[model samples]
Target: MASSSYFEDSSNELTCAICLQLFEEPVTLCCGHSFCSSCLENYWESREESTACLCPNCREVFPQKPKLQKNVILARLVEQMKLREGEGSHSVGGQAEGKDGEGDVTVNRMVNVGGHESHCEVCNEEAAMRCVPYETVCCERHMKPPKHKGHNLVEPEMKVEDPGCTEHGNSIHFYCKDDESLVSLLCKAEHQDHEVVPVEVAVAEFKGILAAKYPPLVESIKQVGSQIQQVHQEVRDTQVSGREKEERLEGERREMYRAVDEKVNHMKRWLSERQSVKLSHLEHQRANLQQEMDSLCEEESTLKASLKELEAVSFLEGYKDLLCRLESRSHFSTTEPAPPRLLDFPVEEQNVDSLIQINDNLLKEIQNGRTPSLDPNSAHRRIKISRDLRMATRTETDNPYPDHPDRFDRYPQVLSSESFSSGRHYWEVDVRSRGRWLIGICLNSMGRKGRGKECMLGGNPESWCLQKCENKYYTVHNNRGTLLSVPGDPERFGFLLDCEEGELTCLEDSRVLHVFRGNFMDPVKPAIGVYGDDGDSVRFCHLFMISFIPFCS
Candidate 1:
């Protein structure tokens, strides 16, 4: 009670000229008259002149707009009145008849002025109190109406005053619900199209709205976070598995290297043995030639000795005999001995010789091991499913696969048997020999029968897809199409669905082409399409939707 009654402003200083009530956002004019920011603007608009602007109180003429500063000191007091009213203070005015008259409302509400002092406006003496209703600062001498006294004076609530709205010189009383903005009388007039309400009412209404949705929003955030954690775990597992694979691959490589080295050594040894055999045969031939040369030399010597001893006739006879003997002896053909056939090097034919490097492709982003296949039951009658279910082709005549609700009737399409509700899933389609095809994911909730919007791929919100039409490629959803300017039709296309992130990505030839993000409210199944010129088939290289965690190798 003591603190509440410290001082009070009973003067009409708090009153606004336009509203004839408490000054809301009070502002002082250059002529020294004060008014509510809103009230002043209202007053000035009524006083606009063709030649010059005039003040309503002083009749002071000016030419342009004025400036305004907010009255922080008075704003605090208004807040205190609110606090006091909330505390259920005794009411001076009955039944909340006034804005701040709800409880313990006194004609003079005490305000802490932070020890600031002011001189009386009338006598220029140290003021004992301020008269809020009358808008005056007064000393004790001017407490009563005498030659220098005033009746409206009251105890000081605050030592200083607060400024009002700059343009209208009024308080911001109304809130524009349409724009969620605060407004004064002047502002409210300009915003006649807006749904304006009192600030208090708007506050309660907006708070209620936010409070209603808070729980669901928080829950959604938590759910998304949990999904992210799962993805993180998958990533960690992939790293560990990759490292293990790396170790295994290294071991394989070493073994292969050793085997190659052994092959090279064996080949070298075989080559050496072949060369030795060839040389041995050549050496025997060489020995026979040498022995024949020695015999010929001895025969020649005998013939020469006989020619010296006998005459021409005897020499001729001896020569003939020598020739006959040479002829009769084992004769050597005038040809070189043929070497044995040489062995050919077997490098390419060797085992563990050819190298193939398995590197990361864009499809590898999705770490999944689940290999899905076309659910034969869901295939169209004209769609021919391979025995392995990995390949599907369109034929002129229907194979008459057993009818199922999930089967597509008119379109040559098939969906994977397994549907993914959450987690990451990746699949690759070999479209190298295919000219026209559509690849994407569709909500399982989508209709399976009829050739209407319900069952149309990339024709409704229920589906997300990338398609090929004629020579052009496109991304489509809900009958809308975005043209894809690509170099050529991709050989192998990859699709990645991150249910947690609510994204569907398209990879063309192991390169990311596009990504779609939004609310994936239902489990999505892989949708394969064959249309346009369909000669080739679609092969599912890897329909990996194995589980929450999947890896290709």
Candidate 2:
């Protein structure tokens, strides 16, 4: 049976024999002493390994046959103590009193055996178990000691084997949230200016914040993408709509153009029809008027022939009566009948007197007609008739009608020699003074009286009038008294007369002359002045005036 000492020594059982404390890597020495493995190994190596077993408590030497054993019973008891102590319960160390026949003797023997057997608190029986030797074994009553002598052993809030600060040899307890700085409790005292929090609390706060904001950020990005898609769709719709409208407007414009083209063609057709009708009407009127003119000409010729015949018959009747009277007088006288004396002489004398009388009457009639027709006052009547005829015929022909009807059949007095000769010619003249002067040359019917009266200036019927025969000439007198003339028509003999000075001189048709006013003979420059029956008055003068002087002069 175990002695009561065994139960009483349970309080000190946790302490190793060599270390004098709870076992850390516990082992049994060869001398049956329980100690920490490191401490027993150190003590054994310190000896010389002599054949001896030394007792650490008693200092007794024994035989050299020492053995080492793992303290399995002690290790099992330590594991049970740690389990009970982890639940925040205190462990007891005293053994239970013997119940049945077994007393303290059994307990003491069990403790001394030092093998793989543990005493159960309830059963009081030896139990087979296996244990690791390094664990500390404590008596159930003394597991969580109330007052540790040297160490303040408290329940570990965190595991002791986890990594910690090597420099401080302490647990890392504080975290720097800004820099994720892992700091020990000791470092917090030095780095007090930094914001430090417990590591567990900071981790929890950061996770909560991230969880709260994540949903809204994702939703905002999705909404922005949706709006962009909507804008793209709207732009496509507007472009399609604009294209449709453009096509519609183009169709309408084409229709409008077609309508306008049809209207223009219609107007052109109407205009062409109207022009054709007007042309036909004009042709009909022209044909009718030409027929009427032809009939009038024929009637006038017939009337003249009838009047000549009537006059001849009257003359014959009168001559017959006179002849009978002469016969009767001769018969009554009886004495003159003897000689019929040269009857042919009286008849001839009578015939000559009658012809003279008829000539005188005809001349008187012609003179009366000439006075009125040649006078300038009758110009208005002639001009009216010419203007009417020209206005009627201008659209139908290229030839211009006469302006004055009375001038149509008359010849011009002042005529160009080129017109009379109907050929090309030229003349030149020189001026005598150093100032502006008017020089003109006129061709008439060998006299000055009819110089402009019968002249036809322009060939067109309406323009051939006496008033149109007027020509103005200007010359600068440079005191070079040589007057040069060139003939416009060379075949006809002609003369130049200075009307104001009343001087006339003959010129060979082909000759050119230059002289002062008084020096007709032996001219300084030879020239010829030509005249003709056509109506131009200054034909020769105009052709030659510029050859003798500068245009400005």
Candidate 3:
């Protein structure tokens, strides 16, 4: 007889340390200790912030969190131990009454062991084993016969579940391929004309399908996993690049401010110097005028005193002195001081042009190839704006949008949020090839409420567009349509609206498709039009990739 301690030790081996229960989906850690996958994962999740991942049993630390590997041998052993325990319990419960009148009962475990309602089919006794070939249950007495000796036998509890139809209560033998369901012979009549086959054949067919599809599915998962990692790395790199660029731009802005301040200070100093020099010159001129006036006053007083003298000698001397002095004074010249000219800063014209050029360059760098978002307020009733505000589609049903003056009511059209009044601006649009559509720039004051030529794009003077009607492309402006002969159906096209040049050019694959030359009077915004709900949609490509001259000029 096996000792109780032996069974207890076997049970302990199959038990998990964390749950104190039999191991379910047992996995082995790096320290060679086994645990239930869920229990270990839960324990690790509770201490997720901890730097070191330590094994529960051995307290061994791993450099990184280790992946759990399933222990197949340990799992099989656990199943065997559970089956043995179940058989032992059944044996203990099976007790037969003794032959004596004392009403005593004795248990014969190996012979009469049974569980639930399982019983021998032939002897009508408690069944202990199942015959695999005959698919019947039998007791130990029947199992020992010569006819059953060569038959494959297993514990009664290990018998396969009945494959019977619940509705008809008949054994299932056929499978309906169309419905992918099991059916009995009687149930087969209900699934007439369906591809019915034997259950065994259906199982093999499904197994074959799984074998064909499994490898590709696994490969796809691996590719997606690799893409996820690549995306993660790209995100990190982009974040770092953005931060660096922002810092550089901030420093440049500060430097520009500093240069402006220094120029202002220098101009102020130059004005102060000019004012001081002008004042000093005016003061010197006033001092000379004052001295001359004082001298003339003294001479006049002497001449009057001479005239009052009666003596001939005094008169003659005074006359001669007066005449000489008057002659000398006549020879000296006194002119009126010239008027002071207004002080002006000597700003060079060429320097002003240079500063303007610098400003233009900076603006080009900032606004060149800028991606504009669609203005939801300007979307038509049938247009649906995406959450990103970059895509707009025409739908069958009207959107429940609130009343706004900017909303397009007459046509399925939408405008961009940004309006360009001047400078060369560029943007790209991706066109779907199914239905009619138009992409262009339009005046902000264009009509929006009526289904007239004024409200339609390229039908009035307020809009210029590249229209796609079926496979043909046309440039329309000012109620005029010019068919453009393009090589192929280009799905992606760009619009270059150079307000300064008074031109709007459409480009396909870097080749100019058409150009509309007209003076734009007002600020123009990017516009898109969807004719109907034929899956015809246009998306604004949010890309800032631009080269030098075309976008800047």
lDDT of 1 by residue, 437-543 (tens): 77788888888887797687898888888888786789999888999877866666677777888998787643567888866747788888887454557778753
Clashing residue pairs in all predictions, respectively, total: 35, 40, 0
lDDT of each: 0.66, 0.39, 0.73
Let me know the TM-score candidate 3 reaches against the reference structure: 0.37
Show where candidate 2 strays beyond 4 Å: 1-208, 300-553
**RMSD after CA superposition, every candidate:** 21.8, 45.3, 21.6
In angstroms, the error of model 1 at 267 is: 45
Error of 3 at 323 (Å): 87
Candidate 2 lDDT, 372-421, residue by residue in tens: 01112112211211221111001111233335433222332222222111
> Would you estimate the TM-scores of all the predictions?
0.33, 0.23, 0.37
TM-score of 2: 0.23
Report lDDT (Cα) of residue 133, candidate 2.
24
Q: Where does candidate 1 stray beyond 4 Å?
A: 1-368, 543-553
Q: Considering TM-score, where higher is better, how would the candidates rank from best to worst?
A: 3, 1, 2
TM-score of candidate 1 to 2 decimals: 0.33
Considering every candidate listed, which one attains the maximal lDDT? 3
